[model samples]
Target chain A: MLVIEDLQVELAGKTLLKDIDLEIRPGETHILFGPNGSGKTSLLMTIMGYPQYIVKKGKITFKGVDITHAPINERAALGIGMSYQRPPTINGLKTRQMVDICAKTKVDTEGMARSLNFGDFLDRDVNAGFSGGEIKRSELLQLKAQDPDLMLFDEPESGVDIENMALIGTTIAQILQKNPPRAEKGKPFVQQQKERTKMGLIITHTGYILDYVPADKGQVLYGGVIACAGNPREIFQCIGQMGYEECVKCTI
Target chain B: MYDLEDLKEKARQALDKKASFGGDLDLNTFDRSFVPHKYLAEEEICAIPQEEQKRLIMSGLDVTGHGRGGTYFQKDTSVIHCQSKEEGIQVIPVTEALKNHDWVKDYFWKLVPVDQDKYTASALLELHDGYVIRALPGSKSVYPIQACLYLDKENLQQNVHNLIIAEEGSELHIITGCATSPHVKRGVHVGISEFFVKKGAKLSFTMIHNWAEEMDVRPRSVARVEEGGIFINNYICMKPVRSIQMYPTTYLVGDNATAMFYSIIVGTPGSYLDIGGRIYLKNRGSRAEIIQRSISNGAHIINRGHLIGEAPEIKAHLECKGLLLKGGIIDSIPQLEGHVEGVDMSHEAAVGKVAQEEINYLMSRGLSEDQATSTIVRGFLSIDIKGLPEALKAEIDRAIDTSNKDSM
Candidate 1:
């Protein structure tokens, strides 16, 4: 399980988020919705332990360990991984080598890349000249190799074209264990849920991903705080009908 | 072809003339007398001391001669071992070739001027033994020929002049390693090399330098390419040297000729390197490219590149990139000259430390900070040469890997 309590975050001496409380147990996937500059990415970055995101008064726990002050690599080693929206390009490092680094062991990088339609780019430098959709596939391919317990996706569908949307969405579902195996198709719902241990927190702007991946809950972040929480589909419908300002007003 | 007496007079006049760059060295402070060693057979090369063999291997000289087409081993001032195992190739000492072969007279000092600087003049006045490697026409080498210039005499100035030629319709590859004995601390080396690429031929020469910390090295080299010919030059110097300076030049004299120069350098503390490459695209449809990578670790390094396009429809480019680590000075100079309106030329030069964002990105993939930095540094030193053989590429990678371990 992953938990955050009273998470107050500051960046570059300016407060970006405050009084944030969130939790996601095993087999649970949550969706985060917010307006521009509403501390959505900041909340995710703070949880990932980026040194730039200073925790003024908060604590983050992952798998029963307090990790509010842990370094980024330590958190990564402890089954925490994130897919960045605009990761920097590392020259001279082949994507094939990067997959091995993420795995920390020998892996079938070529097989994994073929599944993501990224086999051709495995020999190129990491993100040296990748297009928008290609970058997304590269990031997801690394996360697949990592196989972390806690996965974070920041705007997975922002720059994706319509053709790649389904591929990206389905891959995310498979990574989070939202899709049950063929043998478990006839099992009872309770038994299947008990077997799912992967956890996910996805930040989406268009809500297009909800059509492919099921979300257990959704929350609205306004003024650096979670203003409302409800069913994922209902929250999307309400936000679509009325602007974020109206929703925040009614919840407050 | 020319008068030897007149050439001697020119060399005497410029014996004391200072070079255009780098720190000056007093020529009178070192010994110029010849140091002789017994001839070594093919098997005897492996019998050399283990420590000395290790240093030679690091510079890409295979003492066992397993995959080499030929071997030329020069110790101090004499050719201790010179032979060609492959058919269509000839490896002989420069002094012997000039003394016996009539064809050698036409090539000796043909491309490189003898009075360019004090070092070139010194090579002409007190010329020691060097190699003359040539490829027969319409023939190809099965493996690269290996050459080693080993300095074992202390405080001795070794003057050498080398000539290489690739005849028409032939392909040749050469690997030369220059190293010093483990016990020899202080010395000077002056080398003059001239290269000729005949029509429709291809030639690639790779040189690796592994010198002692107190050694001063000056090498003068020039190349000329005929019509439909190709020339590839690679240079790598990773170990420490007190001071070294060289700027090799290549001329595309015939139509559709091509030349490419790639260099990788690492500067350690108390080391000063002034190295660069210059190419002249003189004919129509000629092309030239010069790419250099340099890293300074508390040393002073000056990286220079120049591309000159003298005819219409010619193309040229120059690139120089440097990384400053552990408080050192890196001066990168890239120049492009287009003498005609229809010529195309460009240049890009950058010098800075590794970007932090690149490091942080790697860290997020579960690598520690130290691992991330070294990965970036290794990548920074790796360059993809278009036409290099797989064996040579592997050799370059091994050199970079060893240097990365020491630098980090």
Candidate 2:
């Protein structure tokens, strides 16, 4: 579980996110929709405690502990992980080595690679010459290795093709420990007992990931603030009918 | 052909000319005649501490000195022991080889001409002792021939002229190590190595140097590859040295021949190093690759590389990279020359401090800041050397591991 109250963030002396509030309970997933330069990534980076994301006035609590000014690495150790939209390329560090470092406990990396279909890239430089789909798969693979309780996905479906989108969607669902929508029909009774303990806050613009990852709530971020909160499906339908400007007007 | 007297006179005359780009050490200020010619008896060899002696030997040489193919141990300027088991293979002292074998004169000092610089000239004129390895035509051996050159006394100068010849269709590997005792306060080492790879032969040479902070080292080397031959050179210097200046050159004279140069240099406090590699693709279909990696910590390092494409259809590449930890200076230069229209030559060089993002990424994975910094530094120093035997690779890996530990 995570909570944020009145989080006003500034970058380079310019206010990016103003008076923002967000909360995610255990076993819950929240979908955040915003246009370009609408402070979607700013919110996630702020919560992750990036030094550049200056929090003018706010408090962030994770598992009943105030971690407002925690270091970036400290937040990562405290069960918080993120998949960046564009990760830096490390020249000499191998992909498998990075995965081993991320997995603090013993992990079957070969098995994980097989599941993610990235076995050939295990020995290559991290994200050096990867395609769009390959980079996404690598990010997800590292996140899986981290095995954090709170997952933050930044545009997981931004540049993925339709074929790889299905795989990314299903993996995101599994990471959240949620039953797939396709498996919702004719599910076994024993399968219903699967524990759902992980929480997620995913940022999306196209809303394509909603088809794969089920969200309990949706919020519209406009003008550096949360404009509305409602059901994900209903909010997506409303945004499709009316542009983001109309949605902001209706919410206000 | 010049006789021995003529060559000696030529080298003596060139001893006054300094190298174009010199290091911090000035050989003129020191007395080169203070060196003593002391023989290392069996008991005296064992008198040196085991730890210090072990540091002088290559990583994979754990067996006794007289193990497999051959082993040569030299202290100061005298060859203490030399042995060989295999037929058609000769490992003898250079002075003895020059006197006994009439054919040895044809290959000695032929590849690495002594009149190039004063350091090389000094090594040729004032040479003490070194090894001469010869593999007869069509002979093949899997075991590596090992040699250890060490300085044990103060104010000593060990100038050696080593020659290695691989006849046509032969394959050989040479592993040499150089070190000095901690008590050697003022010393100078000038080593000259010349390698000749005949047609269709393969030769791999790996040298590891661990010297004290009071030593000044100057090594000059040259290799000539004939038709359809391959040459690989791996050079590493991990410990602190007062100054070192070396730039080994390789010439590919036959078609379908290839040459590779791999070097890793670590500069500690109060050290100055100027190391580089030069390769010439002189024949059609000849290829060359030069890779240099350097890490500077409170020291100064100058890394240089040059590739010359002289014939059509020749390919060459050069790469130089440097990592700065604390206060240090590193100058990396990679030059490319294409004389023929169809030849391809390119080079790349980069110098920068370690990225904060990389350290933070590692720290996020449960490693502390120090651990993260060490990990990145180690990765930066670990280069991928292709086409080496598994055993040789393992040996190089162990030496690299030792270097990493000592660097920090």
Candidate 3:
């Protein structure tokens, strides 16, 4: 669903990501592994078309259209959504109002909020005084309301507790329409085996989210370049034992 | 009739004193009161078309006499219309009430004394026509009495003295709309309003003003809430005006008395608005809260809130928030004074531009930049005042929305 070719990104004359190339097909989830300040967020922001993330070179093609210079809202309209690691707080804008704006049509916001156990926060200002878990859930709540085709998760498990992690994991699975964990009572799980066409690119530092998300492919990004490509679990084990320097040496 | 010789002398002396100058707006041109040769009579009042009056009053209030209440209309110095739909509620012209009833004159200028300021002095001495509203003892009203004071002729000075009395155990709501003709070149309005909330009574007052750019407005008001009584004041100014300087004070005099003041002021281009709220907690268990939000777009705005805790067990809070758009200036001052032990007082003030991250966040949710900016501005101007009727809340919301669009 998304393809990036030789993407070189810069901010304030400093190169962040250089010669980055990646592609995610339909029904595929890509796990991006990197260390701190390894340009994981810059890649996602570059794809999302934030004005400050200057595209020095390369083009981002999404759903067969090159949106390299598209505005932020234009990208959002074209089925691109993101969950920020640390979203800013809006003082007077209500959560429900933001949800309403995200929805393409009339949406059952209360029902969605209830499903996420965020009913009490519907009337509060967006992200104002929210805990880390609550902020992650708020981002997920907005993504759920938006129902975008291409979802980008920026460290979903970074600041989440175990209890909330399980809830968020289940909600993310439901939103991405991943294969259900198990069938309902008196219902077969075979129905969930049908085509799952939602595409996602989730950035992770701890690899804790692999227990919930079934990633098809994993790639380590070292020094603003792709270091290696393999199974996410295998790459996590390799990084755990050999460290990122080993992966960079192998790539070189 | 009482002796007026001393009062007239005081008014003459007050006229010599210059207008108070604490606000940041430049009002050299309006330092002296704009005195007209004569106010228009009932015949000349027709110069203001009926459509303009409808636009100012009924368009914003959405009142159709569904419940029991009254309506008062004044054009310049004439009392155009006054009627009461329920018994035990007196709605009459201030002069008429003073001529017939003894209590009207007693409390007319009592709460807001004539010597309070130059504007009050001018209104009391050169005042023309105003309203005297009274909810009798033990009476309760589900609907609000509506009043519209419109400026019709150019260069007309509309000085009014209004008195609202809610007797013991009575409850009433008053909505007053002050506006001028859209094409009015120049005018001056000095309104002195005094409210008396008797023991165990509740009074809610909402004032909405829409003025042209050439109009100057000075509103001086004071309220006395007695024991076990409650008072709520909602003030909104959403239109552009030359200059407006007002800071109404409320005194919680009796035990367990409470006051809440909510103000939402929007300053359009080239307009200068200096508005504030003050409350004094005088007795034990008295409480007061002042919340004000100011939005300035290429205009100058000053939001000031002051609270004083005088007696033990008294509590007060003042909150002021200001949003400055491009080329506009906003100064927020929140002050709290504690006079006695065991008295609590707090204040918070903030002034800044809208957050760019907030705007970008909204845009990522499918809204255009303009849409996102307007939504935040509208929300910033929304003051969630407690104890207001749902209908009045909706009215205030509509007024805020209109102002947001107009300013944009």
Best candidate, lDDT-wise? 1
Q: Candidate 2 clash total?
A: 0
Which pairs clash in the backbone of model 3?
none
Native-referenced TM-scores of chain A, all candidate models: 0.96, 0.93, 0.93
Candidate 3: regions farther than 4 A off: A181-194, A241-252, B1-3, B22-50, B57-63, B66-68
What is the clash tally of candidate 1? 0
Compose the digit string of candidate 2's lDDT tens values, residues B216-327: 8888889999999999999888888888888899999999889999998889988889898999899999999998888898789998899999999999999898888877
Q: Which digits, one per residue and each the tens of the lDDT, describe model 2 over residues A1-252?
A: 799999899999999998888899888899988788999998988877777889999889998888889887788889888877877677777889889988988889988987988899999888888887788888889999998888888898878898888889989899888755344567664455344778899998889889988788999898799988888877888888897778767765
The single-chain TM-score for chain B of candidate 1 is 0.99
Between candidates 1 and 3, which one is better according to lDDT?
1
Residues A70-117 of candidate 3 have per-residue lDDT tens digits of: 988999999999998888887777899989989989899999999888
Tens-digit lDDT string for candidate 1 (A1-252): 999999899999999988888999998999999898999888888877888999999889999999999988888899989888888887678898899999978889999999888899999988989888889999999999998899999889888999989989999999998874456568887787788899999888899989878988899898788988878788888889898888767665
Clash list (residue pairs), candidate 2? none
Model 3 Cα lDDT, one tens digit per residue, B158-240: 78989999999999888889887667768778898999999999999999998878888888899999999999999988777
| Per-residue lDDT of model 1, residues B1-408, tens digit only | 766677788888998899988889998999999887999987888999999988988888889997889999999998889999989999999999989998998898888888888888889889998999999998899899999999999999999999999999899999999999999999999999999999999999999999999999999999999998999999999899999999999999999999999999999999999998999999999999898999999889998898889999998888889999777899998888889889999888999998877777777789898999899888888888878789988988998898789878
Which runs in model 1 stand beyond 4 Å of their true positions?
A185-187
Worst 10-residue lDDT window, candidate 2 chain B: B58-67
DockQ of each: 0.77, 0.47, 0.63
Better model by DockQ: candidate 1 vs candidate 2: 1
Which lDDT values do the candidates have, in the order given?
A: 0.90, 0.83, 0.82
